[model samples]
Target: MRVLLTGATGFVGRGLLERMSALVNLELIAAVRKPVSGFPENVTSHVIAGLEADTDWRKVLDGVEVVIHSAARVHVMHEQTSDPLAEFRKVNVDGTLSLARQAAAAGVRRFVFISSIKVNGEGTPVNVPYLADAQPAPADPYGISKIEAEKGLRALAAETGMEVVIIRPVLVYGPGVKANFLNMMRWLHKGVPLPFGAIHNRRSLVALDNLVDLIVTCIDHPAAANQTFLVSDGEDLSTTELLRRMGVALGKPARLLPVPSRLLEVGATILGKKALSQRLCGSLQVDISKTRELLNWTPPLSVDEALRKTAKHFLEQQSK
Candidate 1:
């Protein structure tokens, strides 16, 4: 079977590529916006000018049965413009539609779209779990684009009869990872005392390996068509517990001070650290029951295993 993956140079994409190295039945095609120098011998890279650019996408789409749309304007720091949503929509919404159309025309069997839990909602309250069927109430510009893309993809599936599987992953963590988690890890290594111990928030997190496994399953799972799945590590961890474990894995004493959460939140609000506080002290747990019940899939990695592997990667990087 032939498959194509966009954003193949990214952290999550790279993990998926590495994991698929043992799949002898798969012919993998990786797409990046610019030319790449090194990749696995089993995969070929195609540089794209734009999703609907003049270049012949058919060449890459040839005989490809699945398209994993991993490329997107990823949610990161700082608002770029007054109209950030418009910019995000161009790449996330418009670009996705273009690729789906081409894949449909090429008779691709399935299109697996990677979305974020942000598309569902940002923070969870108490013991409630975010369901796949939840109405999207994206909180940021990046999430708005993903939600728009989801709507477009569903329409494409209806129009072209191509199966579309959407996987909404929550706070993916693993080796070679970046963003907020990485920053926290760096701070932990530096032995900083974080006030997050006060937060009783439980958040769902997905390991890179677990997410990659789900992506591959979506490619062939018969029931995945026109369905959306919310994924995690199949267990949730409180901020204090998560940091303590990470500290354990790093072989460092976890420096957590049990400061009053209300006082901390007030200070963060005054000092323009609200976003950071939200991330460190918020809850967003998901129920993977739908995924488990339907595909009979269980999260194969333990949280400790995931955290340990991630810490090892960071240590290796520092040594380099």
Candidate 2:
């Protein structure tokens, strides 16, 4: 099979490229914004700048069987654009639909889109996880754009007889993870006193390896066509348990203070960090039973094993 992967330099895309390149039966082509080095000899790199709605994909779409579309205007902490929604739509919704149209016309068999669990909503009721068929209730502009893009892809699939597989993953983490997951690891490594010991909210997360494996399966799996699936590690963790496990992986003490969840929320609100507090104390779980039942897939790596790899990489990078 011949596959074209976008965002080849990104965290998930890079991992996918490395793993897929090693397969003897597959030929890989990387669609990047600019020239990149260090890819395996078996992989070919093609440059297509901007990746916007007007960008032409005819040059690279020929003979491409599967296209894993991972490039997007990702979520930002502090959005600088005046119209954040418009900016996200320009790339995520418009650009994605444009590529799918051209890929369908070019005879591409399957297009796998990497979406976020945010499309299901920010948080879920306790023990009531978000399902793949739930009505989308996006809370942010990025999530809104992803849902819109998914809708467009489904419509295009119906019109063109092309297959569309959408995978919505929750909080992917691994060796090259950054942002909030990295910050938590840093805090645990430094032995900072955290007030999350009493929080019992559950959150689901996916390992990069596991997500990549699922992506590869969807690339050719007959049951995956025109389906929306939620991807996770099949294990949910509370904030306190997650910190404890990460601390063990990092070979450090968690040093957690048993502060009441309500007190912490009130303090955070007083300090104008309510959003941060909510992320730490809220529940956001996803149900992947549908994905497993449909594709007979399970995450290959356990949470502890994945975290150990993540911590080892973090320590190595810190030493450098």
Candidate 3:
């Protein structure tokens, strides 16, 4: 199989490249904005000016049977752009559709898109989880753009015979992780006391390896065609339980104070961190049964094993 992968320098993309390169039957093409170094021998790099609608992708799509679209404008807590929605849509919707159209014309067999779980909603009720077939309820600009891209991809698939597979993944964490997960790991590594003891909200998270595993499965699975699936680690964890387990992996105690969730919310609101608080205190579980049943796929690593690997990497990076 000849697969063209975008966002090869990103966390998830890096994981995919590392694993897919080892497959003897696969030839990987990494589409990156800039030059990437130290990739495997089986992988080829193609420099892209940007993921704009005008960017030409003829050479990248040549001889590619599958296109794994992972590049996009990720969500930011504070966006500096004047029109965040336009900026997000430029890459996530317009660029994505342009690429998919070109891929379809190039006779690409399958186009696998990596989308965000935020498309379902910000969070679900305590006991209710987000299902794969749920009506999209995008609450943010990023999620809205993803939903639009999914809709466009599906429409394109209907028009063309190309298979379109969409995988909506929750928070992905692993080695080289950054943003909120990295910050939390830093706090835990330094033994800073946290106030998440009262947070009992369950969240679904996917390890980079597990997500890559599913992407590989979708590339060849016949049933994955024209399907949108939610991917996760299968095991849900409360905020406190997550912190405690992470602490265990890092060989440290979870120095969490027993603070009320309401008090924490108020404090976060006063500190202009209401959104951050919600992420830490809200339930955003996903039901990934469709992915498992459709592809006969299961997460290769358990949550605990993934956490330990993440902790090891964080420590190594910190020591450097």
Weakest 10 consecutive residues, lDDT, candidate 3? 75-84
Tell me the TM-score of model 2: 0.98
Cα lDDT for residue 194, model 3?
95
Candidate 3 lDDT, 1-320, residue by residue in tens: 89999999998999999999999889999999998789998899999999999989998899999999999999887689989989999999999999999999999999999999989999988879999998999998999999999999999999998999999999999988999899888899899999889888899999998999999999999999999999999999989999999999998888999898889989999999999888898899999999999899999999999999999998888889
Sorted by TM-score (best first), the order is: 3, 2, 1
* lDDT per residue (tens digit) for residues 72-140 in model 1: 888657775788888898889888888888889999989999999989988989689899998888998
Off by over 4 Å in 3: none
Query: Residue 282 in candidate 3 has what lDDT?
Result: 84
Query: How close to the true structure is residue 110 of candidate 2, measured as C-alpha lDDT?
Result: 95
**Model 3 alpha-carbon miss at residue 262, Å:** 1.1
Q: Report lDDT (CA) for all predictions.
A: 0.87, 0.94, 0.94
Which pairs of residues clash in candidate 1, taking residues 3 or more apart in a chain or in different chains? none
